[model samples]
Structure formats: structure tokens, C-alpha cells
Target: DVKVTQSSRYLVKRTGEKVFLECVQDMDHENMFWYRQDPGLGLRLIYFSYDVKMKEKGDIPEGYSVSREKKERFSLILESASTNQTSMYLCASTLPAGLAGAETQYFGPGTRLLVL
Candidate 1:
């Protein structure tokens, strides 16, 4: 099965603190992405990597960054967690050929994060 696993199912943090969220996919897919989902805003991309050691900023990359040292793993780092950063974080991966950058993506269950 194609599975993406996140380091946390839930997280609580204080303002101005650094946070790290790790994700790993067992399928060895070439592309991985990090996104944040809010109540009414839908899913917003934070960062994405198409290959190892390569990264790109997404729509909402202001307070976040990403890393992909290995093909199967990616990490999202919150430089300083803030109240506005509190949301459901999702990690996803897709095959390179068909849907890597297409309209569809396979997502993790998600991590609910709250910043105080």
C-alpha cells in the first residue's frame, strides 16, 4: 500500500517557539508536499520538493520551510509558531509520472496543531 506517515497526530505549541513536523512515505515517490488546511480556506500549500535536496516555496511559505534529504522523507519546519499558524497540517506524496504535479495528490491523515 502507498502510505504516508506523519510524526504527530496532534500538536500544541506556544507562540515564538520552533516546531518540527516530519513525514515519510514508504512508496519512494519522487514528489512530496506540505499543506495547511483551515476551516473555510481549504488546503493551502506551504512547500514542496520534487527531488532529493531540491525544494520550492508554495503559496504560504512565509513562516515555514521544508527539507527533503532523502527520497522517502520530508520535513516541515515552523521557524516560529504563531496563533495564525495553528491549523491542520497535511503531508502528501504522488508518483512522478501521472500525478506528481497534476490535479490529484494522496494525503496523510493530517496533524492537528494548535498554537497558544
Candidate 2:
């Protein structure tokens, strides 16, 4: 089974503090993603890495950054935590396109961050 694990289930940080959320997958998936979800706005991608050392900014990448130094681990960085940055962050991984079940994404439980 492909298992995705997150470093934390909840986090609290003061404004201007730096935070990091880590994610790891047991499977060797080529695509990994970070997303933040809100009540009405739904899920918004923050950043994603398609391959080791390759990354792309997502729609709402202004306050977040990502690192994928290894095939199984991906990390999301919050440079300066703010009240508005508090949300449920999700990490996902999937097989590359053209493979069976490639469209299916395996997601971590998520990290709920609260910036006070």
C-alpha cells in the first residue's frame, strides 16, 4: 500500500515566525503537491514538485515554498506565518500521467495551522 504521512496534525505559530510542514510517501511517486483549503474557496494549490529538484509555483504561492530533495519526501515552508496564512494544508502524491491510476491522488491527513 502507498502510505502518505505528515509531520503534524495541528500546529500553532505566532505572527512572523517561520514554520515547516513535512510530508513523506512510501511509494516512489513522481508528482507531489501542497495545497491549502478554506471553507468557501475550496482547495488551492500552493506548490508542487514533479521531480526531484524541480518545482513549480501554484495559484497561491505568494506565502509558501516547497522542497523536494528526495523521491519520498517533500517539505512545505511558510516563510513568515501570519493570521491570514492559517489553514488546513494538504500534501498529495500520485503516479505520473499515462500510468494506471495516475489520475488518483493519495493525500495526507493534513496539517491544521493557526497563526495567532
Candidate 3:
């Protein structure tokens, strides 16, 4: 079974501060994603990584960056936190596409970040 965990369940940051969101998967999934959930906007993908040291920009990649230094871990970095960037951040992991049930994503508990 795949299990995803986030480094924090809740975070409070000030404007212009750097925020780091960490995610880990236990199943060694090859694909990892970072998403931001906001009311009425649904989930917007921030970044995704398919392999170590390789990352792709998603729907809303502005002001955010990602790193995949290991097979089981992925990190999302907010260069300078802003009030508009405050949202519930979710991390998910899944197997590579084309396999059975490869679309199924295991999600973390989410980190609610409040930027002041």
C-alpha cells in the first residue's frame, strides 16, 4: 500500500518568508505532485516530479519551486511567501502511467499554510 505523509499539518508564515513543504511516500512511487487547494478554485497543481532531479511546472507554478532528491521524498519551496499563496497544500504520489490503476494517487493529510 502507498502512504503519503507531509512534514506539517499546519503552518504559519509571514510575508516574504521562505516556506518549505516536505512530502514523503513509502511505496517508492515514481511520480509525485504538489497541489494547492483553495475555496472555489479547486485543486491547482503547483509542481510535479517524475524522477530524481527532474521536475515539471504545473498549472500554477509561479512563486513555487520543487525538488526531488530521493525516490521517496519531494520538497516544495516557496521562495517568498505571499498572502495570496496561503492555501492548503497537498502532496500526492502515484505509480507511473500505463500500469493498472496507475492513476490512483495516494495523498497526504495536507498542510494548511497561513501567510500573514
Candidate 4:
């Protein structure tokens, strides 16, 4: 089965601290994504990479960035963790181009962050 794993299932950080959230997929999928889920707001994309070394900013990429040095791994970086950044972050991957479907994504369990 296609699986995506996140670096942490839970994280606690102080305000202004830089945080790194890592994700790895074993399915060799070409598309990887990062999103933050807040209560009632649903999932908001942070960044996504379509190909190795290529990345694109998503809807809510304001205080975040991403890196994709390898095809199976994608990393999300929080420049400065703020209280407002406290949310459940999800890492997901999908089949290569031309394969995305309504049920395309394979998501990690999620990493919940608490920024104090």
C-alpha cells in the first residue's frame, strides 16, 4: 500500500523557533504535498513539489517553505513558529502526473504542533 510517513506525530515549539517537518513516501509517487488542518477551516495547502528539485507554493504558504531533494521525500520548514501556527500538519503523496484522481492522496497520520 502507498504510505506517507511524517517525522513527528506531535511537536511542541516555542514562538519564533524554526521547525522542520519531514515526510517520506515509499510509493515513488511524483506529487507530494503539505497542508495544515485547522478546526472548521479544513486542509489548506502549504506547498507541493511536482518533480525533484522543483517546488510550488500552495494557498497558505506564508510562513512556510518546502524542499524536495529526493523523489520520495518532501520537507516543510516553518521559518518562525508562532502560536497561530499551531495546527495539525499533514503530508501527502499521490501518483505521478495523469494519475491524480478524487481519491488520489495517501496522507500521513498527521503531526500536531503546539507553538507556545
lDDT of 1: 0.92
How close to the true structure is residue 35 of candidate 3, measured as C-alpha lDDT? 98
Tens digit of per-residue lDDT, candidate 4, span 1-116: 88889999999999999999999999988899999999999999999998999999999999998999999999999999999999999999987656454447899999999999
TM-score of every candidate: 0.93, 0.95, 0.96, 0.94
Name the candidate, 1 or 3, with the larger lDDT value. Answer: 3
Inter-residue clash pairs, candidate 1: none
Which residues of candidate 3, in runs, are more than 4 Å off? 99-102
lDDT, candidate 3, 1-116, per-residue tens? 67899999999999999999999999989999999999999999999999999999999999999999999999999999999998999999988888455688899999999999
Name the best candidate (by TM-score): 3
Give the top-scoring candidate (lDDT). Answer: 3
Clashes of each: 0, 0, 0, 0
Candidate 4 all-Cα RMSD: 1.5
Per-model CA lDDT versus the true structure: 0.92, 0.94, 0.95, 0.93
Ranking by TM-score: 3, 2, 4, 1
Q: What is the C-alpha lDDT profile of model 1 across 90-114, one tens digit per residue?
A: 9999877554456456888899999
Candidate 4: count of backbone clashes, pairs at least 3 residues apart or interchain: 0
Residue-level lDDT of model 2, residues 56-115, one tens digit each, is 999999988888899999999999999999999999999888845557899999999999
Runs with alpha carbons beyond 4 Å of true place in candidate 1: 99-104
| Greater-lDDT candidate between 1 and 2 | 2
47 Cα displacement, candidate 3 (Å): 0.4
